[model samples]
Target: MASAPGNNLPVFYNDLIPLSSVDHAGYRSRTLDSAPFLATHHAVPLTVDEFVSAQRFLPIIFSAGDEPVPLALMGLNEGVNTFVDDQGKLRGPSYVPAYVRRYPWMLAKLRPDSDELSLCFDPTSEALGAFEDGQALFEDGKPSDLIQGVLKFCEDFEQAAGRTGQFMKDLKDLDLLMDGEVAIQVPGNEQPFVYRGFRMVNEEKLRDMRGDQLRKISQNGMLPLIYAHLFSLQLMRELFEAQVTQGKGPVSVTPAPEPAQA
Candidate 1:
């Protein structure tokens, strides 16, 4: 079920295989009671289109690397998701990222050299299988209405992902990205829990930019997105507090920082 070797699979997906009428004719998409795949994942990839809504609920940060992707921070530490219980259910209403919503299914290139994308799904997920009571995946040896709709959603997600890629490229070209760190000290803990290993917009460089550079970003709508990321940084402490409330915080407060996931 693994794709071509050397390619890293996205989070929440164990293995991917093409979904087709012939191979999965009897498969039905069942609504699972919980999302076990999301239980321990703290970082979720986000499209530029979702920044505004996602920023309101989760801190938006960029991954650490040359080709950094925007991520919505669900928790301060790796292998922890405070918004979701161990059972994989949300604690309350929140803006669910499209990356999570498209779980178990995505559009991927079947061949490394091909530009065409195929509808692929994670075979490991229980969401799609031959179930007696769920919606059919295909009808009359063809994709059902539901499958068609899923295809449309996946296609749209790909488009949004492209735009997100361009936005990241622009940020890199502008040299506005800087290594990020967040330190939060609890009332009782003498030492603060320091979080690092991510990237964020460099506000100092932004202020030092020439007027034309600032105008270019503002006119092209990148300014608002940058501000959204900056504004969301305040929620990092909030997420840490929630983790403490849930009894999933670091074992002991220390001066040394923990490495956050990219």
Candidate 2:
């Protein structure tokens, strides 16, 4: 895709190429042996469709920016994913965001001027290549069933993204999003550790909304998603504890002692 540098690229996709039958006739897709690709990501984009199930496991929050995207928090710090261990094995059972499962394959526009999107794959991904024992990407100059399935998944993800965009727009239109902050008091600590840098639905505003407005949101299936997000906030502390268990919690900053008697 012809996007600005570093704009279109998702996590772990070093290079993306349009999958053409002529150019990739000999290419094959391999099964994921490990998930080391996810070790560096503390959060992954989540679709609105996933909010209900994902909220059961991970805390769902919105990224802070013009285009706010829902994220499933895997950890609280940079380059740390409490869910994925050093060996790339999941620490426990949790909902895996479709964004992570769709890695190595994505839909992208071949040219900036083109309105049609094409199936693209990460050329740098070890999960896909010309392997001896793997599913072929193409057969008889046509995409194989495996490729077809991946394409279908990408299409579904696009649809979900559209719905997610609308959900975010509704939240914005209602002015319900607010700066997300949390304070957790660690045992034996005098001050509570504060966390910020995400956006969340303003429960106060939501509660104060008119009955007609609330009914409209509920009828459109957005009220549940909103409540899911609100409920997921409780997991933030759990995530922090996971980080602490993994030795990636907040660093202790010793307070400076008062000089003599001043």
lDDT of 2 by residue, 1-262 (tens): 1121234465667777788788788998888756888897787888899999999999888887666778888877767789988867788898999888888787877676676877888888888887887899988989899999999998898889889879989999999998888787899989887778888899899999999999999999999999999999899789888888888995632111111100
Superposed on all Cα atoms, the candidates' RMSDs to the truth, in angstroms, are 3.3, 7.7
Segments in model 2 whose C-alpha atoms lie over 4 Å from true places: 1-8, 252-262
Name the runs in model 1 displaced over 4 angstroms. Answer: 1-7, 251-262
Q: At residue 256, what lDDT does model 1 achieve?
A: 18
Q: What is the lDDT of residue 78 in candidate 2?
A: 68
All candidates' TM-scores? Answer: 0.91, 0.91
Error of 2 at 200 (Å): 0.6
TM-score of 1: 0.91
Q: What's the lDDT for residue 45 in model 2?
A: 83
Query: Each candidate's lDDT (Cα)?
Result: 0.82, 0.80
lDDT of 2 at 200: 85
